[model samples]
Target chain A: MKKEMVCISCPMGCHLTVEGEGDNWTVTGNSCKNGERYGIQEMTDPRRILPTTVVIKGAMISRLPVKTAQEIPKGKLFDAMDELSKVVVEAPVKVGDVVLKNVCDTGIDVIATKTMPAV
Target chain B: MYDIIVIGGGPAGLAAAVEAKKEGVDNILILERDRELGGILNQCIHNGFGLHTFKEQLTGPEYAGRYIDMAMDLKIPYKLNTMVLDMERKDDDTKVVHAINEEDGYMALEAKAVILTMGCRERTAGAIGIPGFRPAGVFTAGTAQRFINMEGYMTGKEVVILGSGDIGLIMARRMTLEGAHVKCVCEIMPYSNGLTRNIVQCLDDFNIPLKLSHTITFIHGKDRVEAVDVTQVDENLKPIPGTTETIPCDTLLLSVGLIPENEISRGAGVEIDRRTQGPSISELCETNLPGVFAAGNVVHVHDLVDFVSQEAALAGKGAARYVKGHLEEDINFTTVNGDGIGNVVPEKITVANLDDSVNCYMRVRKVSTDTVINCYIGDEKIATKKARKFVPAEMVNFKIKKSDLEKYHDGELKFVVEPKEA
Candidate 1:
């Protein structure tokens, strides 16, 4: 079976065609090698870096923006978000500070992207 | 009296203030209208920012935080929630910034040089003239982003975005993640006005249909949004009579475009560029008026925040030079938009003030493939840059070396896009 997908690796947005299923795949129509990798990963097991905000206490603002340190399994995005929703951290949180350690046991930590100074 | 006063504490202002301080300007003040310093970046919670500056993909707030930290570390004084009312040139070459806030009732700031970085505002439904009742469900894409990301409020259950801009595309995915059914994104233009990555990651990833060359003709809503009439347009963007389709959606998000907020700049008697709708500036980012400089979105809407910081840094350095009495007064050669180019920043350039090279940021009017951008000083071609693909959504910067300008000292520098073969 042939599957068609657009590579989101860069601004090029190459329209890729994968000729095989599972581990054996031949990707074409990619401008570069990264697009081929993206196409294959997208077909086999897609993953994305979840970027969102979590509630904060004693900060100038009500919420602190966060994202997974690395890309996680696509199926675990909502689960990670659900875990993030339950978190509440204090102010004086610096960027890269772990908001949720090993979020949803995906071995990926949810870290604060911006610093929140104590109000 | 301050040596430099930066209006708007967003990315541009913060970067300007920090750069001015590094340039040995001791007294600098940043006046921000918002209570916080980040500006619109506070609500822009999505990633894919600061890739050039920081060499990493960061969220909007994160990209802003790095600069905010730098400003704070440099001890840059900034007034929060202070709205600048007016600015006027004084007799002694200094400008006075009059602002009002709850803390400071009314104060006039005296500065040797002023940097305007007030940024841009989202164009609303009224700007587009969509035939509709003033409904509660209609919101700008940025406003919806603020509501969902910062305020933690759900905008709607069913959504129909009216533009394929980056904000609208991001919101389609954002609304989807939060359990909103995004029906479709409508763009009047044949090509999307957003980055191709956004079109793929935000829309294609979520299976959201993007209808190009289509527009919303009529919005059917009274108190709340009920439905919107979508229609396919002809080449001239006129709605075809039989192509109307009604999509029942509770919310309509408008992401038409952004206009630079330059009310204060106009009030200060700064010359406005008819094409950019921002301040007409030199290569050094100096405006028409002496001792006044403009950068970032107030000068023109930048596609990336990294470019905004880079441009604002130049303005800061320019302000420092003006204050220190080191800036050179040289004859400037005007820059003109030639074929296929929409507009170019730094409408003029002075040869003496340039260090090594000057980066001219510009956008093409439309998408072109296998094109060469040629910079001609009068009839003599000075430099040429080739691109595989060029789109209006992405800004292209061409660096012209001082050596190139020295060859053609007194002619108009025109940038034109031509076929690669030609």
Candidate 2:
């Protein structure tokens, strides 16, 4: 099997061609080592840093923006968002404050990106 | 009278005011139209900012907080909810700024130097002449950004975005994450106007399709956007007959382009460049009006906020010099766009005013690889910088040292991109 993808590691956006199946793959058309690594990782277990907002109470704003502390499995994004949708945190939340600890047992915590002062 | 009165408390204005204070300018005030500082950064919740300035990837608010914290630590004064009405130069060459707010009513400010940093606004559907009914579902991408990111209001469940701008691409992901089904993004041009990373991360990652050389011909529905007839266009952007395809969607987001907000600058009688639709400025960011300067998006649209901060710092330092009676009046040479260069900032440069080097920010007309940006002073080639890849979506910062400029001070300087192999 052959898979064609664009490398998202940098602005270069190199078009990579990954060949093979399962855990073994041969990646080409990569300008850098990072692109090659990205190609293999993308073919294997694709992950993304999910940045989204959750509901907040008693804050200047009604919502608090949060992002996964680390990249989570791409397949679990909707499920993670489902978990985040039910979350509601109180204000006085500081940056890096854990919103969802170990979300979905993925070992990636959802943390506050901006400070929200109490209303 | 204030030493420096910065207009608009966004990233550009905040950086300008802070830099001016750092340069020994005591009386500096920043006037912001918003209720608080940070400007548009407050609504931009994404995390791709400050990679160059802070050397770390930070969200929009986090990037802005760093600058806001710096200004606060330095005791810089700024007024919120103040809308600058007009700016004019008095007979004495001193600049007077008029503004209004509910708290202050009407107020006039006097400054030795004024910096324009009002930033830019998104181009709407009307700007692109999209034949559409006046509907509630049509919203500019920035407006939709504020609605979703800040106000927590989902614009629609089914969305069709016009124009492949970075904001549009980012919003595609935002809407998809928020459970909105994005139909597709259509671009009239063959190439995307947005950055390449956006296309890969925002669109490709989410399985959202990008239709190039296509545009919305007609919009359906009177009360809300029901569907849009999208058609592919030829090289001249003329729609072909029988090629219209209607995509059903409730929302139509236009992410066409951004125009620099320069109503105050135009009222102040600053010379405007037709290409940039912003003020024509010198290397020091000084406009034709003495004691007046402009930077950031108000001068030209920049791809990176880091460059906006860097440019505004120069304007701040220039204002400081003007107040301290250190800025010299020197002969300036005009910078001309040659063969593949689209536009060049700092329309002109004065060798005597430059400190070490003057960075000329520009864009290429098209995409090319393994190219060389050649700088010529008349028939003499002065500088040539190699670029691995050049694209219109990215802004190129080309630096020319004062020593190199001083050597050829008489003629016009031209910048052209040529193939390295040639």
Candidate 3:
């Protein structure tokens, strides 16, 4: 099977073409090696960094922006959001502070992207 | 009185203030109407930022935090929740910034130089005049982002987004991730106005349909949004009759366009660029008013936050130079957007600086394949950049070296796109 995808590795947005499926794919039309990697990953097991909000207590703002420290399985995005929905943290949470550990057993930690001071 | 006053403490303003401090300018102040610093970047939580500036993909807040840390280390003072009402020259040199806040109600601050970096605002449904009843569910993409990302509020369950701008495309994914059923995204143009990366990661990944050459002709619902009438547009962007399709949706998100926030700049008697709807600036980011500099979205809308920081640095450097009396006085040539271009920034090139190359950014009018962006000083073709694809959604960066501008005498430096020769 042949597949066409856009490499989201960078803002360049290279159009990628992947041939031969099932763990043996040849990616083409990629400008760089990262594009080729992204194309193959997209064709195979796709993963994405999930950015969402988690409730915060004693902060200037009510919610804090958080994202997976690394790319998690795309299928588990909603599951991660569900886990985040019930979780609340005390303020003075700095950027890169781990908000959730091993979200949905993906072995990826969701970290705070913004700093929140105690109000 | 401060040495320099920066309006809007967003990425642009924060970067400008930091650069100004680094340039030995003391007693600088930043006035932000928001409750905290970092501005819009605080709401923009996605990745794909800081590719150029930091050489690493970072979330918007991380990028803003770097500059915020820099400004803090420099000990540059900033006033949050301070709204700058007006800015005008008190005399030939002194720029007065009139602002108000609960702490300091109605105060006029004086500064030797002012940098306008008020950023921009999203164009509402009213701006496009989609025939509709004023509904509560109609929200701009940025507003929805703020509500969902910052305030932890769900906008709606069923959504119909109008315009395929980056924000709209991002929201398609955002709404989907948050359990909202985004019916479709309708863009009136034949091609999307958003970056291709967004169209894929934000929409394609989520399997959201992007309807090109389609528009929301009418918005439905009495109190909250219930539905919207989508229609196909002809070549001239006219809605075709009898082709209306109603999609049941509780929210209509408008990610149509962004206009540079320049009301205060105009009030300060700065010459506004009709093309960009922002302040006209030289290579140094200095406006018509010598001491008054403008950069980032206040001068022209930028697609990338990294470029905004680069431009803001120029404004900060220009402000420092103006304070020390080192800025150039001669305007050598003005930039002209030739065929197939719109709203090129750095309206004028004052002088060729040995330190930094003059960076020029422009948006193409339409999508063109296998083209070369050519820059010509009168008849002499000075520089050319070849591209496989050129679209209005992506900005073109053309940097003119000091050696390239050395031979040019004066007049207009025009940038145009032409088909690649065989």
Candidate 4:
């Protein structure tokens, strides 16, 4: 199969062409080495990070925003968001506070971006 | 005695004044450097402004006209052509502002509170460090716009735009419509910083070529711009050694970026945000100094004029509260930028009184697909949003509900941009 992809690794959108035969793949048209590797993995397994709001208790607001500290499996976006929805933290939370434990079991924590006050 | 005296008479200043008046501020005046009430809007002949504020599509002048008419109806005091040169804080509640106009020379005023809304200035070739001899055909995009749209003068027959900003894209089509051949638009960045609609309508629709990751390495000209040396760049933004192309053109318009005009703000001892090159303020638009406020481009460069109006209104209202002796000094919490984020606006956050919501504006340092922007209040997550694509060109606006703000008592607000899960 021949695959055409746009390299997002940098500002230079290098049109990538990937050819795969039986268990082997050859990539070309990548301006940089990192983009070549990114194209290969993007062709195989596409993953993304999940950023969503979570329920907050004892804070002034009903919900506080949180996101996976790093990228997770692209196929697990809904699962990650579901996990984040069920996650809640007490108010007076500080920035970078870990609100969720074992998010998607990817060993990544869901962290908060804004400070919240507690009564 | 007046609590605050705002500089500039543009939409930003006008909106600020109106907001202050609506907040019951009786002693407020606006100083405009132009004879008319509207600033840049006086010459903007196209539509597409005021979609967020009035919920109606209007031209730049029309939108500013609406606000000016509103200020007039509200009897907002404004002095035309009053150029503010210097500003300094008198004590805790007073500031000294000096200005000059054709009618009055070296006029000075004192106010209890001050609002800086001088707006922004276009980035010139000198700022970008482009190598070129002094020529007659080189002009800023805004200048060419004013010359053609307002002064009814032709800039040139052939043109080359240096940046893909909104103004440049708009001018690409404008120049094309005026029977000028726009050779191309050169941008060093991979993704365009302009609005998607503009890229489609202005460049794509007009059949203008947009060269990504390319820059004008040098200019070749004597008395007028004759040609530009275009070159592609590597990942590090350094021009690649072998790839160099030249295009012939008589005029070169630069729409690189807009810098906030805040010399007066710095002179007034106001805290400046290094990232946005504007003033750092709380959600109320109150600066670090008491009785001083900032809004619009003077605070941060806004892509849409409507957002500028919205922000200016907040500053105006905040100033009114300061004059009425109702401004809160409980701005204990501060907003901090985290990983992947370029900068955050309204650098301070005060949840002391959670009556109204707060809007936090920020930008990303790089472009990413399927990204997640998270807001953390110290150790806890307050908000997060999934983004399909994030670019440095667009400013992200996030609103924290008053109810949610009440939950977090005290901690620093942080914004983080990271790639989304697979």
TM-score of each: 0.95, 0.95, 0.98, 0.77
TM-score of chain B of each: 0.99, 0.98, 0.98, 0.97
lDDT of 1 by residue, B262-374 (tens): 99999999999999999989887999998899999999898888899999999999999999998775756888899999999989888888999999999999999989899
Locate the minimum summed-lDDT window of 10 residues in model 2 chain B. B327-336
Q: Which whole-number lDDT from 0 to 100 does residue B357 have in model 4?
A: 77
Provide the interface RMSD of candidate 3 in angstroms, 1 decimal place. 0.9
All candidates: TM-score of chain A: 0.91, 0.87, 0.95, 0.73
Deviating ranges (above 4 Å) for candidate 2: A1-5, A12-40
lDDT of 2 by residue, B246-268 (tens): 99999999999899999999999
| Reference contacts preserved by each model | 0.57, 0.46, 0.86, 0.00
lDDT of 4 at B124: 95
- Top DockQ prediction, candidate number: 3
Task: Put down candidate 3 lDDT per residue, B1-422, tens digits, no spaces.
Answer: 88999999999999899999999999899999999898899988889899999988898889999999999999999999999999989766899999999998999999999999999999998899989799899999999999998888999999999999999998889889889999999999999999999998888878899999999988888899899999999999999999999999999999999999999999889999999999989988989997999998878888899999999998999899888888886888899999988968888987653365788999899999989889998788999988889999898898888777867767788999998988
- The candidate, 3 or 4, that scores higher on lDDT is 3
Can you write out model 4's per-residue Cα lDDT over A12-116, one digit (the tens) per residue?
Answer: 346689888555778898767866776777777754444445667887556554556665676666677666646667888865688987777888887764455
List model 4 lDDT by residue over B31-149, tens digit each.
Answer: 99876677886555444577678765455656776888789988988888788999887655578889888887887799988888899999999999988786889889899987776
The lDDT of model 2 is 0.89
| Model 1 ranges off by over 4 Å | A1-7, A10-40
Lowest summed lDDT window (length 10), candidate 4 chain B: B42-51
